[model samples]
Target: MGKPETVRLVSKEGFEFVIDYKAACVSNTIKNMLSSQGNFTETELGEIKFPEISTPILEKVCQYFYYKLRYTHCPDVIPEFKIEPDIALQLLMASNFLDT
Candidate 1:
């Protein structure tokens, strides 16, 4: 079989996340980056770099992307996404930057 479609996201601290394209596209910003009409670097390389987002926040954003994908259409109840109080502000900023 052909290789699965994926995208690489790099955080400011050099943490890299390799995730399915479908999952990554859960974020509107990422979807546009990957599928924009113009020829951008991210589209060509299948990678996005978050220079202002830290590793922990980026990790949580990635997790939320997958969680949103998995639970979006489920009939069962979806669990809340947990965030530590300390990182809440950072996560919110990252989420805004990602347009999640």
Candidate 2:
């Protein structure tokens, strides 16, 4: 089957974020989920559910994915990736789990 242009990521709260496939691949874990040799359900459906990540954290992760994609080649002009203090710990945990 042809590669999907986008992927759906579902947060623990059931919020879904549809992001570009290239952007989603910024996370090594997600890249593996979609491209691994095993028959991953995510590979077939192009969707993944993060049960440990809340909506807000997942949203930030999605944003970071796009940001990383946009600034990957341009090292000089990359902006800081901001995280709100309230969710900073949670975001870090999620990022670690996702291997982003």
Candidate 3:
């Protein structure tokens, strides 16, 4: 089979996350960046750089993306997504930025 469709998301500190394209598109911001009409660097390179989001926050966002995709149509009960109180604000800000 051919290579799997994936996209790279780079955090503010240059932490890179390579994830499935479908999973990445769970975020409206990422989806637009990858599918925008203009030929931006992200679209060309299949990599998006989030300059304001920290590595830890980005990682959590990626996890949420996958979690959303996995359980969007599940028949079983979905578990609550936990977040530490300290990082909750940051995560919320990042999620707002990502438009997830």
RMSD of each: 2.4, 2.1, 2.4
Positional deviation of residue 59's Cα in model 1 after best superposition, in angstroms: 0.2
Q: If scored against the real structure, what TM-score would every candidate get?
A: 0.91, 0.90, 0.93
- Give the worst 10-residue stretch by lDDT in candidate 3: 1-10
> What does the lDDT read for residue 5 in candidate 1?
92
TM-score of 3: 0.93
Q: Compare the candidates by TM-score and give the number of the best one.
A: 3
Please provide, for model 2 over 1-100, each residue's C-alpha lDDT reduced to its tens digit, 9 standing for 90 to 100: 3349889999999998999999998999999899988778898889899999999999999999988887888858777998889999999999998899
Residues forming the 10-long window of minimal summed lDDT in candidate 1: 1-10
lDDT of 1 by residue, 1-100 (tens): 2123989899999998998999998899999888888888788788889999989999999999989998998999999988899999999988887788
**lDDT of residue 80 for candidate 1:** 92
**Residue 55's C-alpha lDDT in candidate 2?**
96
Tens digits of per-residue lDDT, candidate 3, 8-97, equal 889999999999999999999889888999888888788888899999999999999989998999999999988989999999999998
* 1 or 2, greater by lDDT: 2
| Runs off by more than 4 Å, candidate 1 | 1-4
